[model samples]
Target: MGTRKFQGIYQLHYEEAMGKIQTGDLLFCSGSYLVSELIKKASNSFMSHVAFLFEWYDRVLVFESVESMGVRIVPLLHYMTNYKNTGKKYNGGLFIARHEKLIDSYFDQTLLKNMIRTGIDSLNRNYDQTEIIRILTRIKLGVGKHKEDNYEYICSEFVDYCFQQIGVRFPRTMEGFIYPEHIAADSNVYPMFEIVS
Candidate 1:
């Protein structure tokens, strides 16, 4: 049999993909730890976490909101190769997706810079610990509307909020529901490369 593709696209070594990244790119991760597994199961998606990216001079930086460390920025290389300063590659798949809609004429350098600045300003924001529980409870109870608080965020919410800053809304139309799956399901978002860690 042919080698199985990661999310329907051939995987590439981390080094091979590093140079092709751009600002506004989306990073989707399928983590394997206990909390990762729980999040994936709860969301019914292989992707448990998501982050936004922007290039800084020469390095690409990942902006994300993680449980242990709220909103923060780190070089993309450090994140994929030596995750969390552990001196080891990340323990799961990491892929990049591009927004075809915004990458067009609609989104210009000004918006890109503004979005990057917004992400930078969001650093140190509180991570909403109750977010997972609330999302799970809403899902289980079939709640249609989700009230939102931008002050604190889960991973995906942070990504959404940053993109929303530039007036580029997520494709998911469901009221108050934005997650890894929803972002990946956006018709304009397409897989570009996967890290062969």
Candidate 2:
């Protein structure tokens, strides 16, 4: 309904914007929901969620972990349309970032295949509620240990794990804690585009 931009980032129409997204790009979303609000507050960031993108059988799929649906891959269109279908006023837009160094210097067909396979293998994993709690706790206390287990993962953690499979590492303060803002702010990842519909 209204235009909003951060640091001169422009919002484009969602349908026309899909062409800009490429495989292995990171998507940071400022969702419209109570949980999203809490995440934004706790993380001190505009983005509340993050997902990894890949082209699967000609369809762009986003790999992410959410409390409602653990780790899973869904069509990118589905992700963009979810809030619209709910008939709720959603203000959050989707922001995309790509690892230019990885794409230009390291990415190849085999590595891409391995990344997809690794993401697929992680399907059905549970969302790490404990990690979320820990993050909140850390935010409150201003200090805490970063710990995570393989049993489950949070959104950014899942993305980090997938990239690690292909020998790429995103910035992480600790072994297990990775926030959406961390990935968004990483120097290696270049902001490509944003979409709001």
Candidate 3:
């Protein structure tokens, strides 16, 4: 994507952005840390992580797998504020992306509720350390095999799996090698808005 196009995308405050997110929307984050830096380098994209949105009982939650937290649901506002407070130096910060086709074809109150339940079903699963190591090793050595294991998940894999549950598949050449850049670059998804702070 061009810098000018990215710059022209709508920007919103965290709170306002949270209010606008709908279930199944993708949340791509540019984290401020060493690991995030490594991920950006490996993927060659601005976003290092991705999550699926799930709004429940007036609170919006993000479903993602992190090295520290594994598969879990976190309050969306809390996630954004944590980054906003700490990631002053990062560019593109955090942004929301929506699959235009999915929104038009699959999004509805009932479908969203079901999607949230799908995410809830996978809570507490461990983060896929083997996959992370494999990805890093591949990026380092420039050769390795990519494997997909659902017993645990990395962030993008979790998002990919959730969408698959609803019959929407994000593109992947290899089964388990979904990266943040893959989702960001998907033809089906488009940037809606970004959070500046």
Candidate 4:
């Protein structure tokens, strides 16, 4: 019989490092590219105090030092469109850590506002959520374009939607949120974040 080799064991062992997050967290979410660009452009911006970048099994999330506000950073996978429930697949992306601590800084009003605005804006823009979702599904089947052209406008509207939700001033130049659903992983788009308390 020929010699068969099984999988080798290595001494190096790594554990999954998940940031402790809880409900009632105050998160300052923005686009991944926008934050990175701002950091590149403004060396002394508020993001200068980034402790570490957090990578989840799905998406890439960043962390920043928010001075007295505790830890804050932008959430990944937050695209400008309402693609989360479209029955499409989005691969992994970036994320921000210290979710629980961030939520402690502000009331739940902000998160609620952001979600509401996003949903409403899509409706107001004459975007049939069901139809758009169906189109996204068709695109995945290679039947049509990914609708990349509409992405820019959708993203722009998303920013406005978010602002309307929080009713607070955030960086205008910010971009999109990185979510796992956008990656075309599979039919089910996984949520990259849990509420941080």
Predicted structure with the largest lDDT when compared to the true one: 1
How do these models rank on lDDT, best leading? 1, 2, 3, 4
Q: How much lDDT does candidate 1 score?
A: 0.78
User: Looking at candidate 1, what is the lDDT of residue 75?
Assistant: 87
For candidate 4, lDDT tens digit of each residue in 1-197? 00001012111111122333232122222223553444323322222112223344654343322322322333323222222344432221222222222335555655654544454344334322332343344434534322322422222233333333544322221122212122111122112332222
The residue-by-residue lDDT of candidate 2 on 1-197, one tens digit each, is 01122345867777777777778888888877789999877777778888988876778888998887789877777766664356443457778778765568645768877888888888999998888887877778866767755668899888888887767777766534788877777767777778766
lDDT of 3 at 64: 87
lDDT of 1 by residue, 70-112 (tens): 9998888886668888998888888898888566875567877
Pairs that collide in candidate 3 are none
Q: Flag regions of model 1 displaced more than 4 Å.
A: 1-6, 143-145, 171-175
- The better candidate by TM-score, 2 or 3, is 2
Task: Report the error of model 3 at residue 7, Å.
Answer: 5.0
Question: By how many angstroms RMSD does model 3 differ from the true structure?
Answer: 3.2
Q: Which ten residues in a row have the lowest lDDT in candidate 1?
A: 1-10
lDDT of model 4, residue 21: 28
